[model samples]
Target: MTTTTRTAVVTGAARGIGAGVAKRLAADGFAVAVIDLDEAACKPVAEEIEATGGRALAVGVDVADEQGVQAAVDRIAKELGEPTVLVNNAGIIRDNLMFKMTADDWDAVMNVHLRGSFLMTRAVQGYMTKAGWGRIVSLSSTSALGNRGQANYAAAKAGLQGFTKTLAFELGKFGVTANAIAPGFIETEMTAATAERVGMPFEEFKKAAASQIPVARTGRPADIAHAVSFFVSEGAGFVSGQVLYVAGGPKA
Candidate 1:
């Protein structure tokens, strides 16, 4: 929110929604840090930002690792200036019916979606508070409402809604706001994987999903990005502790 140097850090920015968000924030005039587990995978996104005459940095980090997350944040602050905007978009899916789910599957989802968000937010909040202004947006999903094979994912995402609200309450005095975006049926690599897991062609899966939505179309990464852009914008300072359902219909 500071006009001097608005650096944004977006996790899982190598591809999909994270990448889209990184690009959008860059265009919004923030010095963006494109972070992913594979630093190499993050290069293309950062490079694309640079090509468009925006500043960006590619950093490799496992968001659930305490040391890794702290180190990545320190580096971003030094390289791109203090990160006042943090997008916790790094997540994984381990979908299974409860009877078929393994403990590992459950832990994996929690570690990435819950623990990862915790670590990343902990690391970045200091800069935001120091700047006296910030925005934190975590990606939730319609699955948080309950999906057939996503018990673990649903729990983790639901947990994030609470996390965002708590952050909003705790950080409001520092001019920091936190909100969650629960997207529905977004067309991304993750959704493609879901389609494969369900033995449906990706195109057919999109069509089937679109048919049930009021918008009559599957959501795109850019759609999520647009919502995020609003949350992080200067005008959204009063908005916090909200879970925005970006589903095509009235899902919330």
Candidate 2:
């Protein structure tokens, strides 16, 4: 995006891909709100941005809580500025075979991925609509297509695609565009946890995953961050209701 005084909020931004996206937006000249479940967790990223001459605020709030979400967004508006750009990147994985999945696992995934996105979007869209311009990018996953042992995650990611498309339809008239970035095999703490769960060293797991990727390597936080940068750029105004797969290959 061209340098603007606009403010952007990136949820789950304490680390990994969300942190990368938050920093990138700050570099792109938007005052950024780095939000996570823990405000302290967000300080490093927000402080780094400010140290680099960018405006940033670290806010703590649960995206899945309605009142908390509203209160957080309101605080952002007052402390930062009208947030017209949003990245819904907060998520959790409760991977399990269908027969082994618990209702709690499913609910937890749905509440954070689906409900969180909905509430965050709802809280931010008013500013977007009133401003007559906005960009929203939600994190989806290749799992959405179907993933073994990730029924809960796959369903939530797939649901977000539908959610993103609907937002495009409903908000297009107001000059707001919505899109999703479905990443595949990005190296992060979450993936390391997966490796541990499966009894493999994280490095070996990445090597095995890389062998199958056309790019000859796994994706990284920067890869997804670059994709988000594109979707929210001023030049991307015409793109909406789209899912861009940044999986280092045409298919994931």
TM-score of predicted structure 1? 0.98
TM-scores for every candidate against the unseen true structure:
0.98, 0.98
Model 2: lDDT to the true structure? 0.96
Where does candidate 2 stray beyond 4 Å?
1-4
- Residue 238 lDDT (model 1): 97
User: CA lDDT of each candidate?
Assistant: 0.94, 0.96
Q: Write the per-residue lDDT of candidate 2 for residues 50-159, one digit (tens) a residue.
A: 99999999999999999999999999999999899999999999999999999999999999999999999999999999989999999999999999999999999999
Stretches off by above 4 angstroms in model 1 are 1-3
Error of 2 at 175 (Å): 0.6
What local lDDT does model 2 show for residue 129? 99
- Looking at model 1, the pairs that clash are none
